[model samples]
Target chain A: MAVVSGSAEQTVAHTPSTPATPGAPGQTIAIEVVNLVKRYPKATTNAVDGVSFSVPQGEIFGLLGPNGAGKTTTIGILTTFVRQTSGEARIMGIDVAADPMSAKQRIAVVPQQSNLDRSLKVREVLTFHAAYHGIPRAERNARADALLDELGLGDRKRDRINRYSGGMAQRLMIARALMHSPDVLFLDEPTNNLDPQSRLFLWERIQGLNARGLTILLTTHDMIEADQLCQRIAIMDHGKILALDTPAGLKTLIPGGVSLELRVRHAREQPADGASPLLAALRALHGVSKVDETGSDEQDTSGEVTFYRLFAPDAGALIGPATQAVLAQGAELRDLHLARPSLEDVFIYLTGRNLR
Target chain B: MATTTSPTASNLADVAQSTPPTLSLIGGAPRPKHSRLGLILIAFLAIFRRDLAVTAREFIAFLIQVLVQPLFLLFIFGKVLPEIGAAQAGFGAILLPGVVALTVVLTAMQGVTLPLVLDLGFGREIDDRLLAPLPVALVAVEKVLFAAIRGLVAGAVIFPLAWWILGSDYTVRTDRIGMLIGIMVLTALAGAALGLTIGVLIKPEQIGLMFSLIMTPLLFTGCTYYPWASLGSIKWFQILTLFNPLTYGSEGLRYAMTPPQHATVYGHTVTFAISTLATQWIYLGLGGTVVAFFILGVWLFSRRVVS
Candidate 1:
C-alpha cells in the first residue's frame, strides 16, 4: 500500500465547498415511491404496505420507525437491494425495478453494519469501493484520500479495518459509500452502534456532506437522531407511514405543547380511593387537556408513589389549578414538573405505545 | 412540491453525473468470466494473504487441521495399509497421489465453504462483497480461485511427506506427469465447484449437519482408495460411484499416475478419461450455475428476510 503524506489523526480543515443549497422545490423529483407493497411469501403480514412518498432533490429525508416497522425494508427497495412486490420506486426519474443498474449508478448506500474487509487497510476499503464504481485506478487513490480526510479517517487510513473502533469503522463505511461521489446516499441507521460523542461527530459529517449537495435519505429508530438531522421525517408503523412532516410538525399532532409531570407523595396511601376526587377536580382545570397515568398506580405501589405524565395546553395556567387541587385534596405533593411535548408523545398518539 | 433545490446543489449534481459519461472507454457487457490476469494475480495474492492472516491467528489449529490431517492419512496408508497386508500392487505409492489430490481438493473446498458459511450465518462478510457493483458471479469465481491455490499448496506440502514415508518401494511411473497435473487441476476445480454449490445452498447453522450428511458421504463414496473398475462384481457399487463426480476425479488421477499394466481395469482406460472429463465438466458447469442461483437467492432472501 502506498503511504500518504498526512497522519491518520491530522485534522484536515474541511470547508465542504460552500455546503450546497437545498434543491429547488418543483424543479424535478429525485425519488418517487408510489403505493409500494412488499410481502414475504410465508410471512403473515406485508412488511411494507401501500407506502408512498417523494423526495425532491437535495433534501435530507428521514424514514423513522421503531424496530420491525419496515423502515429498512422501504430503503431496501429504493436502494435496489430488494424488489418490491408491488409499487414503483424511481430514482432520478429512472424506475429502480425497470433498470436497477441505472438507478444504482445514481445512488450510494451505507448499510447499518460495518462490512469492511478486515484484511484490507482503511484506505483500500475506499479504493476498492471506488473500483466497483468503475473509477479509474489513477484517480481512485486521490479521491479516496480526500474522502478519508473529509470523513476524519485520515489518520487510520493505513490500519487494517479490524483495528478500527466501532466509530472508526462506521466513518470508513461512510467514506467508502461516498467514494463514487454519488448524487444521493441511503444511510440505514448509520449511527446504530456509536458512542454519543461518535454519533454527534458522525452527524456533523453527515450534515456537512448533505450541505454539499448530496441528497441524503436515511432510516433510524432514534427519534432524537431524526429530529436533529433530518429536515423532513416520516413516522412509520406496521409497514405504513402514519404521518410525514417536519419534526416540529409531527410534535404538533398531539393536542398540547406542554406536558405536566406529577408524582403522588403518600408513602402508604391509595390514590385510587382519594385520587378520583382529585382527578375530577384536576380535569376541570381551565388549561388542562388530559391527565393520564404513566407509571404504577398509587394503590399498587408498596407505598403511594404514583407518577403521572399529564398533557396540558398551558403549563403557566394549568400548574396553578393542579397545585391548588392537590392542596385541597390534602395530598402531599412529591414533585411536579412541566415540559414541552416530546417525540414520545407523538409516538404514543399514533401507535398507542412508547417507542421502547 | 418544488421546495429544496438550490443552484449549488445542481452544480454539484452536474459534476458527479459527468464522470460516468466516459464509461464507454471500457466496453460494456459480456465481461470476461475470470478477472483480468493482473487482477487474478492480485486476487490470488490478496486472498492468500488474507487466509494466512486468519491462519496466523489460529496457528495451532491450522497446523493440526491443514497439515496433520493429510500427514495422518499418509501415515495410515503408507505404514498401516502395507503392514495389514492390504497392499494391491504398490498401494502405498498409489495412495500417495490420491491423498495429495484429496488434500488439495479438500483444502480448497474447505477454504471456500467455511468462510462462506460464516458470512452467511454470523459474520456476513460476503454480504459486503454482494453490495459491491461487481457482478455477483465474480464473488463466487474469486472463492473458487482461492480454493484452487490453497489446494495446490496443500498438495505440494504432502508430496514430499508421501515420498519419505513410502521409501524406494514406492514404484510409480513418471511418464504420466503431464496427465497428473491435468488430473490435479480437474480435481481441484471439481471440488471447488461442488463446494461453491454447497456453500450457497446450506445455511450457516446447518453447516455441521451438512458436513456429516452430505460432504462425508460424498467423500466416502468417491472411490478414494480402489479404482471404480475394480468394483466390477459389485454392480450396484460401481453404478453408484459413476454418479459421483469425485469418483471420476480420483479414477482420472490414478489413471494419469499409474502405468497401463498396473491399471485395475483394462477396458476402462479410454472410457475412464472420456467419462471423467464429461462428469467433471458437467459438475463444474452445474456448480457455476448453482452459484449464480445462490447469489440471486441470497440477495432476494436478505431483502425479504430483513423486510
Candidate 2:
C-alpha cells in the first residue's frame, strides 16, 4: 500500500452506499478534492460547487454525470489544468494549488479533445513528452518505443499524427499520458464516440493499468461502461454529487431496489393529482416504498390508461396482491412489468429532476 | 532532422540563466532535489526541441516569408535603382543595415507569435506543454528565449545573403562588429517579446487583421528603409517611431555597420553616422522594451495557461 497523506477528506453529503476503501492504514489517496468551487469570470453560477471526493491507490473510480455536470471541471482542477476559485485539491497528497509543478509530476490527464501536435511524427511526440518530464534521452526513447508497442502505435511511429483516425488518436493520447508513468491517470469521456473494438481495447488497458497499481479516475456518460469498469461510481447533477456507490450498491439506492410498472384503466376521467384506492392500497403494502402514476401524454378524456410505477423490493412477489388491489378499485389492468433496476435506472432515480 | 537527438537551437537557449525550480514534493520516489534546476533545464530544452522539429518541417516556407520582402526592398531601392542610374548607390549602404534588422525582428517575432497563436487557439496543443513539470511561467520564458536565438541566427544568415546580393555595394566595417552583434541580440529578444504578447492575446481569426492593423503599422514606421534623423521632415512621425522597438534595432544596426564616412549622390554628401540615433539611446530603448514586453507576455501567458 502507498503511504496515505495527512489530510482527512471531509464528510460527504452523499456517501457511496458501498463504502470506498477509505484507504486502509498506510494506504494512499491517489486523488483528493474538497469543497471545490469555480465560477468562470463574468458567469452567474459556479461550474463546480462544493465538490469533494478521494480515490485510494489501485482503485478505479468513475464520475458519471450528464453534459453540464461538474465532472470535467473537478478533473480539470485536480490535474492543474484549471484554477479553482476556492477550496483544496491534492494529487498524491501534494497540494495541487500550492505547487502545481510538483503535483503535475505525479498525475496525467487524457483530455476529452485531441490535442496532439499535428506537426510531429508519432515517436517524437512521446519522446518530447518524456523529455518535458525530465526523463533522460535513452530512457525516453525506450519508454516511447515500449508504450507505442503496447498501445499498437508502433507501426505508426514514423508517420505524422495528422492522418490518424479518431481511435488511433485517442490511443496515442493515452500512450502520451502514460509516458511519464504518473501515479494517477484521469480519463475524461475516454470512450464517448469509439467503435466497439477500440472501446474494448481501452477498457482492457484501463483495467490493466489499475491492476498494475495505477489509480484511475474517469468520467463517462456510458452507464454500462461505468458500471462494469468502476469499483465505485459517483452520480452528479448541476455541479453536485447526488449519489455515490458501487454498481450494485447504486442499483440498491432506488426506493426498494426494483420497479413495478402497470398500465390500468381508470374507468373515469382522471387528472394527475387525482388518485384512487388502488394507489393507497399499493402504498400500504409491505416493502412498497412509492407508487407513482406518471403516465404518458396520451391519457384519454373519458377513460384513461394510466401508468403506475411502483417502487418496491421483490416486485415479482407483489404482482398477485397489486393486481387484486387494482381490480378492487374498479380499475382494469392492461399491462404489467416487474424489473430489477440497472445503474441507468438508479441514475434516473437519483439525478433526473423529472423523476426525483 | 531527428530533433530528438539534435540539441540544435535549444542548446543555445540553455546558455541563458534560468530560475530555480519551485517544486517541493513528498512521499514519492526520492527526486534529485539538488538537480531540480536540471529538470527545469531539460523541460526548457524539450520545448526548444519541439519548436525546432515543427519549424524545421516548414523551414523553407519560414525563410521565404522572413527574407523575400526585405530582400525585395533592398534590391529595388538599393541595387536596381543604383544600377539603372535612378538613385544613389549610398542608399544601398543606408538600407542594408536596416534590412538585416528587419529580418532578425520579423523572423523572431513571427517565429514565436504564429506558433503560439495556433496552439492557444483551435489547436489546444499548448495543453501538452502546460502539463510539463516545469513552472508554467518558464514555458513562456523558454519560448521567448528560443525565438530570440532563432532571430540571431536569421540575422547572421542574412548578412551573407545580403553580401552576395549587393556584391561590391556591401561596404561594412568589422571594427564595430561586436556592437553590431550586441544590437542583433537585443533586437531578437525585443521582437520575440512582442511576438509572445501578440501570440497570447490575439485570436486565430484576428491573425490576418493583426498583420494589417498592428504589424503593418509597426513595419512602416520602424525606420527600416530610412535613417531616424531623416524623419525630421515628419517630426511627429519621428517621435512616434521612437515608441516602436524596431526603430531602435534598425538605428543601432545602421550606426554599428554603416561607416562615419559620407557618400556623394549628385554632388550631395549623405552622412549616416550623424543621421542615426546614438548607441546609448538605442541600447536603452531596446533593453527596456525587451524587459517590459517580456514581463507582460509572461503575465498574459500565465493567466492563459491557468484558466
Candidate 3:
C-alpha cells in the first residue's frame, strides 16, 4: 500500500561499489517503472503493488521471483499489455501509458507462454513480426534469414510451427522478437519448461545478444539462471520488490558470507554430552561465525551419523580447521561441502522462506 | 587440446560480433528515418496481411461453412418453391436478394465473432496483433474491416449460385446499379458492425446460444423470405422486425432489385409510408446502425482486450 514515487532514478543511480555489476554510471535508462499498481476487476488486491525499478541501457536486468510474484505483471505493464491503476512507466524515455505506440515501437516482448501463430512457417513468423513494425518486405526477409541462421533455426524456416518442439518454438519466438532490432526486449520466463540443453543454448544466445548492447529485462524464478545471466536482479514477491542489486551484491547481504555443511558418523553414538562439545568446538574455530545442528531423516537410527552447518566469513579457509575440529570431537567425518551464500540463500534470509 | 565450437555456436558468435542492423523488413530497404505515421501504417498493413493469409490458408473450411447453408436455402426457396408451382413465377427474384442479404449477415457474424472468440479464449492469437504499434481501437477496426470484406465476398458467391439455380425467374433490375451497389456495401458494413459487437459481448461458451437466440431471430424476422411491405398486416411484427438490422438490409435490396409492378405494397398504410420515404430511411437506418454498432464494438473491445 506504500506509494513510492520518484525513486526509480535514485535506485538506479546508487551505483554499487562492486565492479561486477553491469552497466556504466549514467547510462541512459531503457525502462523506468515508478510505483506501478494494477488492480484487476473485482480483485481485492493489486497484482503489482507500488513496484518501481529501472533497467539501464544494454544491461540484462532480471525480475526474479516465484509464480504469482508479479514479475510477469510488471512486464505486462511495461509492455503496455496491462493498464496500471496508478503511477507511471516509461520505455526508452517514452511514457508507456501516455503514448503506448511509440513505446511499443522501441520494445519487443517474449511472453512466458508461446503466442506464435502455429499455422505460419518459422520464416513467416519472423517476417510478419517485422512487417508489424513497418519493416519493408525485402528487408524483413533478409533480417528473418539472418535471425534464423543466427538462432540455429534456418533449417526449420519453411516448416510450420505446429511441428516444432518446445525448444524450437521458444527459439522461434525469440527470433521473431528480434526481427525489429528493438531497443529493449522483455523476456518473461523465457526458459521455463525448456530442457537443460535448450536452456543452455538459449542462455548463450541471450548472452551474445547482451554483448551486442541490447537492453533486456528478463523475468525468472530460477535463482541460478538469474545469478548466471542477470547483471542486476530485483527479487520480487507478493507484488513488491523485496531487494534489488547485483546477484553478488545481494549474496553479500547474507549475515555470514559462506556456509559449511558437515556430516559426521559415530558422533551421535557417544553420550548426549558429546553433541554440545562438537558444536562448541566448531563455533570456537577462528573464522567461524555461527554453527547450528540441522536434523536429517537420513541419519542412522543407531546414532551413527549427524549433520551440522557452520557459517563463516570464508568457508574455504575454515574447511581444514572445521574438519579437524569434528575429528578432535571423536566423530568420524563422512562428507563435507563448502559454498558461498547463493542468491537462493539470500532470498531465504530476506523472506524467511524458500523461494519456491 | 584445443577447444572446438559447433557451426551453430560459431554462427551465433558471428552474429554477436556483427554490428546490429536497422530493421529493413517493413518497407523494402531500411530507411535512415521514419515518421510515426509511416510506422503506424506499416504496422496496420502487417496485421491485416497476416489475418488474410491465415484465413486464406483455411479457405476450404471457410468455403464449406459459408457456402452450404446459403446455397441450400437458395435451392429450396428459389428453385424448389417456384418449380413446384407453390409460388408466383417471379418468386425467385424476390427470394434471391433475401438470400444474398442473409448470406452477408451470417458470413460477417461468423467471420468476426468465431475468430474473435477463439482468439480471446483458446488460441490467444490476438495478443500478437494487439502488440503492434497502433491504437488498440485500430486493431478492433481492422478486424471489423476484414469481416466486412469477407461478408461482401459471401454475398458475391451467393449471387451467381442463386441466379443460376432460380433460372429465368430470378431477374434483378440492373437499371438502378448505383442503388444496388450502395445497398450491398451498406448491408455488409452493418453485418460487420453487428458481428463485431456480438463477438465482444458474448462469451465463448454462449456462442451456440447466440446463434440460437440472436442469429435465428435476426434471419427469420429480417424479411429474408418476405418483403417489408407484406408485414403491414402485422404492425407489431413490423415494429419488432425493425430492431433487426438485417430487415433494413433486406428491404433495401428488395427496393433496389425489384420492379414497381412486382413490389409488395399489399398493406396500404405501411407500404405507402415505406415507399414515400423508402430510400432515405433505409439508407439512414443502415448507415446509422453501422456507425453506432462499430463505435460500440470498438469501445467494448478496447476495454476488454487492452486492460
Candidate 4:
C-alpha cells in the first residue's frame, strides 16, 4: 500500500490552493490507491484483488492487461463510480470512500464506453459538465468552446451526440471529462475500438495533455500503446499486477536482454559428437550469455541449414565475434539478425502467455 | 495542432498560486468562489436543467402520454354518461377532481419512474449524471423534484381540458382556492415521491407488471370514478384501499374543490364519516406518504447508483 499525506488544498475545500495549481513536479502524488479489492455480489472472487499502486503528479501511468483483468474495476474504484469491496483509494490525497465528493472534485473519468448524453448537442455536454462543477454560465461557455476547439470538435459543437461516429464520441468524452479541469484523469481503454488514424490522433492529444502536466492514468491491453505513451506501467492479469516498471526496464526481465539468431550451412560433414561443435563454439564467444539450437530435419534441396539462437547482454558487440566463431567452425552463415527484447516478450516472460 | 494559451490556466493561476497546472489547463481553476452548499445547489440545478431540457424537447410526446387516459376518463364520465342519462347531471363535477388527481399521479409516476428504470437499466445514461460532485442521494431527490414539477404541468394541462370537455355537467367551486392549490401541490409531491420509490425498487422487466399489479389496482380503487365515502358499502374495499396513496390524493382534491355541504349531503347517502376529520386525515396521509417514500427513494437510489 502506498500512503501519502493529504495536501492542504484537498483537506480544506475552500482554501486558496487549487487542485490544478502546479506543485513541485514529482513531490505530490496525484493518485494513491491502497490494497484495493472489489467483489461483485454472489461472485466467488474479487474483480480487483488487493491491487495497490500510486500515480505521481504529471505522469502518464498505465495499467496494461488483457480483458476482464480488473483494469476497468480499478479505474471505477479510483473515480468513485464503483465502491471497493475493501481497502482505500485516494484521489489528489483525498480519501475516495470516506469523502467521495472531495475525491470526485479532484478527478475526472473517461470510461471505456461512450457515456455521453445522446440528446444533448456536443457543446451542451461540456457546458453542463462545467456547470455541475459549479462554473458560472459565461465561464462554462468559454470553457466549452475552448475544449471543443482543443479536441478538434469545434465545427461539430452544435451537432447532436447521436450523430457522432465512434472516434468523435470518444473525443467528446475526453473533452467532457476535461471540462472541470480535474487533477487526475482516468481514461479506461480510451482507444479500444478506434481506427488507426483516430488512435494516432488521440495519442498525440494525450501526450500534449501530459506535457501540460496533467496526471493521467490510462488502461490498455495494447503493449505498443503502453510502451509508447506511459511513463511507467503496471502489467496486470487475473486482478493482480504481475510487473511494474518503465517499458525498457520491463524488457530487461527476459532471460537474455537480446536474442541473436543465425541460419547457417555446414562447410563440411562433422564427425559424430555428443553436441554440435558450432553450438559449443558460439557459447564460448566472449559476449554470448546463452545458446539455443532449433533442430530442423528438413532442408532446402541445395543444402541442409541449421538455426542457432545466441542470447547476449550486448548483441551488437557480439555480432563480429559470433560470426567469426561460426566461420572458424567451418559453418557458412546464410542469415544473421539481432532482436532486442520487446514489451511483448516481457509480458510473455512474466505471464507465460501472450496478452490476448 | 495549433498551440493556444489556456484561458483557465492563467485565471486559475492568478487565483491560487498552488493550483496544479493540470487543473488550470483542463478546467479553468477552482477558487473559494462558492461555498460547499452553493456548489451542491449548482450541481442540482445542472442536473435539473438537463432533465427539463430533455422533457421540453419531447413535450408533444409527454402531452400525449399524460393527457390520453385522463381525456378518455373525462369524456366517458363527464360527457358520454350525462348525455346518455346513465349518470346524474352533477356526476361529472364529482369525477372532475378525481380525473385531475389521476392525471397528476400517473403522469408524475410515468414521468420519473420509467426514465429512471431505463437510465439504470439498458441506457445507463444515468452514469454521467451520477459522476457529478454531489451526494448521490441528492441527485435522486433532484429527479423526484423534476418529476414533481412535470406532474404539476400535467395537472395544469388536464384541469382546463377537463373543465372544457366535461361542459356544463361539472361545476368547480372556487370558494376555497387556497385549499385547492395546497391540495394540488401536495398531490403532485406525493405522486413524485411514490414514483421515485417505485422506480428505484423495481427491475426494468417488472415495469409492465408494475402497471398491471400495482397501478391498475391503485387507479381503480383511488376513487377516480366515485367518492371514497361511496365505497363504505363494500367494507373490505375501504380497508384494502387505505394502502393506496392515490386514494388520499384523490379524496384531498375532492374535499378542496367540491362544495362543503356536498360532504354531508353525500354522507347521508352512504353513512360517511365527519367531513372535517376525513379531510384532515387525508392531508396527514398524503404528507406522511410523501415524506416516507421520499426518504426511501433517496436511500435506495443512492445505494443502487453508488454501488
Candidate 5:
C-alpha cells in the first residue's frame, strides 16, 4: 500500500465546498458516504459496516482491497444497484436513496462483468446505450462519434462486439459508460482480466479522463496499480475498512522499521548452542528492534541455510555492529539486504497477513 | 514519515473528510420524468432487437424450424395421415387454422420464456437492464412486448406455406380478413401473456421441466387437434378443455377462418355464429390482458432475485 493523504471536507446534508462556486473555482467534492451500513439477509456478516468515504471533484479515487472486501458492495450501494441496509450515501450532493435519478444523472457505473450485446456491433452498443438514457438521436450521433474518436475506437466502430479483443472490449465498456459525459465515473475492477499491457493502457486513459475534470471512483485488488495511480487508498477486508489514508501515512503505521535479512550457512546449527557470541552481541545492539529466523523447508546441496530477519528503527545504526558481531563468532554471512517497509508490509501490519 | 499524531484524532479526521455527499441533487428543483413504463419500453426494444439479430444469424435454423415446422406438420397431419384414416375428413379445413394457432402460441411462448429465463438465469444479461434507474415493472413489460412480436411473426410466417400446402380448395375467406386479424392478435397476446407468466415463475434450469410439466400437457388437453364438440364422446375431456386458454384462442381462430365449427358450450349444443367468434375473441382479449397484469404481479414478487 502506497501511503495516502486524504483531503477532508466538513459536509452537512448537501453542502460540499466546490470551486464551481465563488472564491474557489476548482475545489469541489464529488462523493460522500456517512455511517454506511449494509447487511445481506441470511449472511452471517455485514457486507459493509459503518463505512464512510468521500471523493473530490476531477480526481481519481481508488478503493483498494483484497477479495471479499466489500469494495464492489460499496460501489453497488452508491450506484443504487443495491439498497443499503442502513446508511447515508450521496453522489454530487444528491441523496441516492431519496432521489436516485439525480444521482444517476451525474454518475455512470461500469460493472466488473462485461454486459455488452454480442450480436450488436460496437457502434450499435453506443447508440443503444444513448437511446436508453433518452438521449436525442442527433446528439447521440455526435456524442458517439466524439467518444469513439477520443477512445481510438473510431475505426472499429462497426465491428461486432464479439469480435473485439479484450482490450478493445474493455475500452468500449469505458466508452459506453462515458457516453453520458457523467461527472463521476464508478469503475468496479476495470482491469480485472486484462493483460498487463492492456491494464497499463487503460490506466493511462483513466488518468487522462480524471485530468479532464471527470471525477473517478475505482476499486482494485492490484497493490502496485493502486500505488502508482491513486493518491489515497482505503485498505478493506471482510466488509470493513481496516485503514484509510495516504499511502505514505499507511506505511508510517509500520513504526519506523527497516527489514534486514541475512543469509548464513549451517543455519540449522544455532550459533554455539543457540547463544553464540554473534547472536548475543546482536541482541545487545541499541538500534535493532526485533529479530527472527525464517526459511522454507527446502534445502540446496549446501546442508541447511538460515536467514536472520531483523526489524530495526535504523539499519545504518545497527548494521556495522551486527556484522562485526557475526564475524567475531566465526559465522559465514552469505548475503545481507535492507528494505524499507513497503505497502505489502503495511498490509501485513494492519491485517496480520500478507496481500496476495 | 512520522506525523506523531494520536490514532483517535487521525481516525476522526479521516472520517470527517471521506464522508459521502448527500443523496439529493437539488433542493426544490423539478425532477426528471423517469417513468417506469418508458424504461420498460426501452428494455423491451433492446431484447427484441437482440433476439431478432440472433435469429437473423441463425437463418438456417429459422428456415427449417420456424418456416418449415408448421408446413411439415400440415402435410403429415392434414394430407398424408388423413388419407389413411378419418384424419382427412375436413382435416385441411380444420388443421390449417389449428397449426397456425399452434404456431402462434409456440412462437409467443418462446418469445417470452426463452429470453426471459436466459436473462434471469443463464446469461444474466437482465442485470444490465435491472441496474438501470428504473423499476422492475419496466423490465417485465419489455419481455411481454418482445414475445408479442415473436408471436406475430410466427402467425404470419405460416401463410405462404399454408397457401402452397392447402392450395385453392381452401375456403379463402378474404371477407373475414378483419376478424382473422383480430383473432390472430388476441391469440398472440394470450400466448405471450401466459408465456410471460411461466417465464417469471420458473428458473432457466427448470425450462425443460416446465415444457414437460406444463406446456406439453396444455397442448395435449387443449382443443388444438380436434374440435371441442368432436370430443363430446369423451364428455369429461370436453368440460376440461374450457380451462385451457389455448382452447379459446384456437376455437376463436377456427371460427374466424373455417366456415363453421360443430361445437358445444356449457354442456349445450350450439351453432357457430358471428357473435360466437366475437365473444370468444372478447373473452381471450380480456383474459390475455388480465393474465398479462397477473404476470406483472408475479414478476413484481421475484424482481429482486432476478435483478
Candidate 6:
C-alpha cells in the first residue's frame, strides 16, 4: 500500500477527490465512544450524558452545537483533559482513561482560542511541540521548518508570538499541532471568529490535511462549517446527541425535504392574513406535508401580504397546485420561493431551539 | 501564518530543490516514540528548553530583574555603610549571607510565579506544556526545576558581584561548601515551590493584592534585614517570622556562610562570623519548607492543568 503523504498534489485542491465522505464499511475506527457520561465536580447535572459515536479512519467528523452543549466536555474526555464520570472513550483503540499518554501521542488538538506561547519565537513554537512528542532533535528541526513553510509561517519565524495577528496565531497553532504529524487531529470551533479570507484558508488547509488521509474530529457551533467540512455531524444539545447523520441525511429527518414560501394578496386588497379558504385549498394538494402562516409584511402595498411556507416531499410537485390554490381563492401570487430544508431547520425541528 | 505572499513563497522553489525532505512536510517522518521514562524526560526537557530560550532572549530584562535590588542592597549594606562608619565591622559578614539568600529566594519565586500566574490566569499559554505527551504533572515539575535553576544562577551572579563590590570587606564563607550548597539548593527549590503554589492559587487581578499583602510581608519577615534570633526581644514578632519560607531561607544561608562568633563593632574581617539560628534548626526548617511547598505546588498544579 502506498503510504498517504502530504504531497504537493494534496495542497492543490483536486476536483477528482470528493470532500472526505464517510469511510467505507469495515474500515478501522480512529475514534470511538460508547455511552460516555461526565458529571463535573459539584455539578447537579451531567455535562455529557450517554453520548456515543465513532469516527472511522480518515473521516472528518463534527460535533455541532451551541456553547455549553457538552461539545468541549466530550472532547475533554476523549483528549484526556477531563475524566468521565462513567463510560468509555477510545482513540486509536487505546482507552483514553487507561492510556492517555499513548492516546495523546497519537493525537493533537487545535483549540478554539490561540494557546500559542507568546514568549517564544514563531519557529520555536512548532519545534518545541515536536520535541514534546519525542521527535529526535534533528528530525524535529526538519519537521518544524517544513511545517512553518507548509503553513506559510516561514517569514514570521523570528517574531515573538504576541506580534502576530489573531489569524496568524491561529495558523501557527495549527502548524504547531501538525508538527508531530499526529494520526488524529481535534479542531475545537476551528473557524469561530475568523475573518472570511482566513476562514477560507483554514477550510482549504483542513481539506488538504484530510486529503492526505489524516483523521479529523472537529467541534463547531457553525452549521455551515459543519455542512461544508464534515463527512458526518452529530448535533448536540443539553449534553446529548440530539441527532447524528450526514448533512443531507439529517435534512431528510424533517418530514418534508423541501420548503415552498409564497407571498399572497387577496384580489379585494384585504389584509392578507391566512384566509381559511386558501389554507384549506393548499392543504389538499398532494406532497404537501405541512403548512403554516409564517408571517405578514407591508411592502409597497397599503394592505399586508401573507407569507406562508409549505413543506413538501418536492417543491416542484407543490408549486403549481399551490399557486393555483392562491388564484382559486381570488388572491394574487405576488411572490414565490423554493428552498431545501437546511441543517439549521433540522436542528430547530429536533430541539425546538435555535443554535445561536 | 496569514502571510500569503511572504518572502519565503518566492524562494519555495529554490528551497524545495535544495532541501530533500521538504516534501515530507506533514507525514513522512518516522516517529520514534520513546519508552515511558524516556518519553517523560524528553517532554520535560523540551518545556525546560523553551523556557530557557525565552529567558535567554530576555537576558537583559532578566538580569535587571534578578540583579538591581540585590546589587543596591549589597552595595549600601556591605560597602557604603561600613566605609561610612554607619554600620559596625562584622556587619558585612552578617549581612552578605542574608542578602544572597534573599536574592536567591526572591529570584526563584518571581521566576516561576509571575509567568505562571499570567499563563494560567488569562493567557492559557501553558496549554502546550500541559498537553505534552508526558504525564501533565511532569510538565509542572519541569517548571519548578527551571525556576530553581534561575534562583541558583541569580545566587551565583550575586556572589561575584558581592566580591567585586565589597572587595575584602565582605568575605562570605566558602569553608563549609557542601553545607552551603545544600542550603542554597534547598532554599532555591523551596522558593520555586512556593511561587508555583501562589501562581495557581491566585487570579490575575489579585496579583496586586498578592504582592502588597503576601510578597511584601514575605520579604521583610524573611530575616533578610536582621538575624532571626535578633527578634528574640520581640518574641511575638520572632514567632511570626517562622511562618514565612524566606525566613528559613535567609537564616539557613546565614548559618552556612556566617561564622558562629559574635559580630564585633567596626571590624570588617574576611573570616565569616555571626550569631544566628542553630545549624540543625536551619537545615530542618529549610528541608521541611521545601517538602511542604512541593506537595502543595504539585497538587495545585495537577488540579489546574488537568481541568
| Candidate number achieving the greatest lDDT relative to the actual structure | 2
TM-score of each: 0.71, 0.83, 0.87, 0.88, 0.75, 0.85
Candidate 3: segments with Cα more than 4 A from true spot: A1-21, A264-281, A293-308, A323-333, A340-345, A352-356, B1-32, B56-61, B262-277
Better of 3 and 4 by TM-score: 4
Scoring only chain A, what TM-score does candidate 4 earn?
0.86
What is the CA-based DockQ of model 3? 0.33
**Per-residue alpha-carbon lDDT of model 5 for B228-285, expressed as tens digits?**
6578698898778777777776777677777754466888977663223345444654
Against the native complex, each candidate's DockQ, computed on alpha carbons, is: 0.11, 0.22, 0.33, 0.33, 0.11, 0.30
Name the DockQ score for candidate 4: 0.33
lDDT for B165 in candidate 2 is 81
- Residue-level lDDT for B126 in candidate 2: 79
| Candidate 4 local lDDT, A1-356, one digit each (tens) | 01122343333222122222223334666777778999999999889998887766666788998898999889988877789999989877788898888777778888788878776778888888888888788878887787788788999888878899889999999988888877788898989999999998888778667656577899999988888777778889889988877776777788788788898887666456638888888899887778888756857665567888888778778789888988998778888998878788888888899998
User: Of the pair 1 and 3, which is ahead by lDDT?
Assistant: 3
True contacts kept of 1: 0.12
Q: Which stretches of model 2 miss by more than 4 angstroms?
A: A1-18, A22-26, A260-311, A314-338, A353-356, B1-34, B263-274
Off by over 4 Å in 4: A1-26, A327-332, A340-345, A352-354, B1-24, B27-32, B260-277
Fraction of native Cα contacts reproduced by each candidate: 0.12, 0.40, 0.40, 0.42, 0.06, 0.50
Sort order, TM-score high to low: 4, 3, 6, 2, 5, 1
Report lDDT (CA) for all predictions. Answer: 0.66, 0.80, 0.78, 0.78, 0.67, 0.79
Instruction: Please tell me which model should have the higher DockQ, number 2 or number 3.
Output: 3
Give the Cα-based TM-score of candidate 1 against the true structure: 0.71
Between candidates 2 and 5, the lDDT winner: 2
Cα misplacement distance, residue A23 of candidate 6 (Å): 2.6
Residue B270: error of model 5 in Å?
14
Q: What is candidate 3's lDDT per residue for B89-122, written digit by digit as tens?
A: 6777777778888888778877888878767766
Interface RMSD, per-candidate values to 1 decimal: 10.8, 15.9, 10.2, 8.9, 11.3, 8.3
Residue pairs of candidate 2 with colliding backbone atoms: A16-A244
Angstrom error of the Cα, residue B103, model 5: value is 1.8
